[model samples]
Target: MEIKFEQKIPVLLEKAGKKGMTYKELSIKCKAKKEEGKYFRLAVQKCKAAGLILEKKGKFFATQSKGLYPAVIKRLHKTYGFAERLEQKDEVFILGSKLKGALAGDKVMIRLSKHTRGNLPEGEVISFIEAGEVEFTGIAHLTKGGPFITPDDIGNFDLRLEGSVKGVADGDKVTAKITKRGQGHRDLRAKVVKSFGQATRAAACCEAILNLNGVTPEFPPQVLEEAKFLAQRGIKHKELLNREDLRNEVIFTIDGADSKDLDDAISLSKYQDFYILGVHIADVSYYVREKTALDEEALRRGTSIYYANKVVPMLPKELSNGICSLNPDEERLAFSAIMTLSKDGKLLDYDFKKSVICSRVKGVYSEVNEIIAGTAGKEILAKYRDVLHVIPLMKELSDILHHNRKLRGAPDIDTAESKLILDENDRIVDIVPRQRGEAEEMIEEFMLTANEAAATLAKKLQIPFVYRVHEYPDGEKLNVLKETLQALGLPAREIKGNVPSKVLSDILDEAKGKPFYPIVSRQVLRSMAKAKYSETPIGHYGLALENYAHFTSPIRRYPDLTIHRILSDVVTQKRSASDIKKRYSEFVGRSANASTEAEISAMKVERDCEDCYKAEYMEDHVGESFDGMITSVTSFGFYVGLPNTVEGLVRIEALPEGQYQYDGLMELKETHTGNAFRVGDAIRVTCSGVDVNAGNIDFVPAEPESDENG
Candidate 1:
């Protein structure tokens, strides 16, 4: 007279319907079997306790809801080469057999079975919970009857195009809109919305990347109109009348040689026993205002995106490059942070204000670096001599500030950056490494000082503001990194808890001058979480600062503009604490999410452009072997970076005439030969093929006997 646990599930599922049911239903569903009352109630209690059933509405139901077919769900571990089943209260399984065409990032519904003691839940994918295709960017390949688009980036599903849309010829890059999603057998349908010419590979790649990430560079027409109006009514003398005029101050802007949209300027002078450092940033919010088309558009875009060869500005060009730019010899409105510091880099006093300033000179980094190195050209040195006089002193002060930062646990990560040099035709001529010199460091140190000062002022005023926070690395990730480093014969201390920036800095310093330095440093950095803008005051672990915010480049960053507005309100004492708190809290929250998304989108476009350039660079060097470092380790293969900073994958199957095994904890090695290849290991690899269309580099390890033969 015992009621079985399996017998009640179907009856419960019928009651749950599409809305779903809860755990208590199981007892009621089995109540009709009179003599088995105790057993039925006990089974319900056991399932609830085991997290296999959810309790709702005095009913018992399976955790994954009751109506759908169940299959076990597992995450595809790309690095580990295995699917690890997920365990959670609401767990359901998606049967691999029922995956259909669903790719990663797709949400699916599944049914669950009775929980087995001490074993994983088994389920199958019954139905898709959501459809994922939003947009696609790729090249249109036209056939005689119709056109098909092959995706150039992620979201790999191809689309079929009709005759009208198939006007876009083969090799023509296009952005397509997802017209209809496929059900089971049919592929998703799309139509070409815009066609970019086939000649520009970098632009095509950028568009593809943006499409893949669900970001677009199109500006609203209303926003464009608003920008035009702002451009026409440029900053006037009347606007400067009531503001603190620092026009006569020796303020100057330093940027890249070809840079536009100058956002910040710096001035320094002696005031009694303190050095008065003025950091003036473009007051974008002043003109754009709140809730206007310009402001809303800026909020939507979040921040400017600077690709290698092009810039996708957050604001319209008329505003970002004209009115809001802190151009030399023009009176521009700005939100200024004036700090009084002692000779030893201690903050004594500070004032933030909305002011008007005129930049006396526009300096480029190369010119300043040459002048600081005492090897300036005559014309350049003459034009900037007055400003250049303080270059040496500023460099020394920057060194002092940098030293203090290191002592306080700031990481001096020496990651190299590369620049793409293009000719008049916009074709890349060379890939050059950009060195960090004293001039660059001097500017960076002062900018960091200004940003920290602004953040401190905002905190003291108890105003809500967006802070650029870098949290500590995850302990689990650090453990894996430590184990890998130890396997490479490197000393690694267990940093399994809250590791300070100083500890990471120490590790980085110790790894310098070694063959594995670059790879290890990159791996350690990868272990750390990404720095992001957030409303909450999470400390920045990378800089070892408690409060940090972006306050320098309002012309490029929306948060900086927001900071400018808050600082302006604080200086005027015009708003009550409660009002400021309420207004800025909402502003910071929205800006934080938007800025993070925009930053990620910008990086994608940048990296895509870099890959395009690298692919072009390798076109001429196919079949040549080069010495490289194994930069990344993955189950599928290892990525090797040549001296030019171009990375290619050496697949496990491509190992030199040996069966290779990937050790999860250590590295890759030959099964029979016992030869090992760890991350950061040096190896000579021959480039076998260059898939320019796919932006992939294929490499094969060079045999040792080939070296001897040569």
Candidate 2:
């Protein structure tokens, strides 16, 4: 009979006691033949790799000894890496040589050593239980040994290609998959799986970015077929049995000039003491039912992503831009929130219902802003003739709401988003700041009112649902902000734990209209926690709202779709409270987690893609000088932002000759000259170099210059 080493090894080791047993003793206990010796040795290696046993002093033990901890590798640098403990928030620093073939995101067992780098604990990886899946996007180059890829994310070393480069040549942008993991960057091997034209072209680099982030433009055939079939079905009378017919209401959508996935519309009516604000969102759940292929795909994607002139929509255009879109003069299914607000913008009462609406016009933000300013052209006025009466009322309600938000201390931070202009050949020509108008604010206020109503309804009924939550900032981050403020000669408050939103709002209010407003706003934003979807209704800190849910834009947001689905059951009285909870408890948790992860992924993709386009545009203007402000300072360098929203790095080495040291807050100072570079300092910079493939722009001070303090 053959010994099952997998089952027998653990028991045998445990039976051998704490003293453990040597390899020869274990083989003897198993009664293995000469040929089986090799098999036994292989099984022991497998056991060790799986963390089932630990070997010390030539003896194997089934249980782990003291000081051994489980950790996940968080990041890998050229000479070192950091791994976070699985049981706590602490991190361990491991030198590249001690990584033991571990990669980022790998789960491994580590043993702490009597060493420390700064404040971090030092450790060495013992064994890896799992490998992380990471794809590398880079420019492929031919070397004497073979072909290698210089990754865009990491510049420490190149990844060696294991096989022949058949279709890929030098200077081509490519994506590679890991074929073999190694101890460090120098030994890792990968295989080229895709090639995207030349590396010099921003379009090709953008394509590689999409693949690297797993944002597929094309959908599965089954999902597309289902979407097409459902779209063709159209709106049937039987499906509108309990829905309210509001097709005559003067509802309209306001969006960008080129937006096609129209999701939300607004209508307002004035009363003596209160206003009836009707926010009707597209009923996407009517077509995308639970567990269907279309629903699965939307859930996987979570949200739509827009970059430059391109979009990776969560739903197929057949539904997003066709059936579920709220187009002008088209009767479409909608979920309406009829909110009654006081004259002072306080919510008095609300009702939600299934309805049908016909949009009066497709409103453009710029055109509406022009109309409000009385500068619109005759053609623009003629386009909005049907819904002209409601424009003033929209503005009135938005102003009142804005005042209310200010009173309640909601910090208004403008990050100044960038817009990229592309030529006929898909090459970027210019970069500029994206403009926002009053029409955008009006629409935003309406959406917030509707979202708050939805969450209040869910809380009143105590139902399981997904919520958009933003918690308070961490204490450590807040402390860092206080130190930075004091360093810049700004007011610093004494915060015990978590400070309220009003405190940060006051700081911003004081800094408004000043040259340092940008720097102050950036610091406040960095101190705030990120908003995410959750099954629990944690109030949003930034919005200063106790109740909030994403009830608008169902066509583009998965959380909004989920809210619509749950409200369907409540409004139709299809299920009792207990039944609803039993059916959706687990579902809500899963959707919230999946949606949060997908949203983060989509954000990264958009930011990275925008950087490549910006670099491409900057490539044409090299050596041109521009006046810019220092937006941020780091240990290695500082970043400068131009009026067009383009940012570039000015490394410490590029500055005037001096021994400079970082103040660890917001200033980089030189020891001998007493010169310093601080945030919000005005300086002249000349574009020195551009790396389109890596999305990097380098800048240096133009001609003779002195530090900000001088």
Among these predicted structures, which one has the highest TM-score? Answer: 2
Tens digit of per-residue lDDT, candidate 1, span 1-710: 33366456544655565455544444455554656667766765554443345545655455545544322223322111111223534443333344554434444545545643224455545455445544556778877767888755424345787537634667887877666665532366778877766724654555666655655677789998999988898877677776898888888888888788898888887756677788888888788788898888787777787766677788888878898888888888888888888888887888888789898888888888888887888999888966876666677678878988989988788776877777676666777677667778888988999999988888887789988999988877898778867877777685778888788888888889998888768867877889999987778999999989999987788888788777777777778888888778777888888888888777866777677767766767888889999887777789898777788998877876777778775478788989888787888998987755456788888755545656
* Superposed Cα deviation of residue 20, candidate 2 (Å): 5.0
lDDT of 2 by residue, 124-150 (tens): 997777788866788899878778888
For model 2, name the residue pairs that clash: none
Cα lDDT of candidate 2 equals: 0.88
RMSD of each: 7.4, 4.3
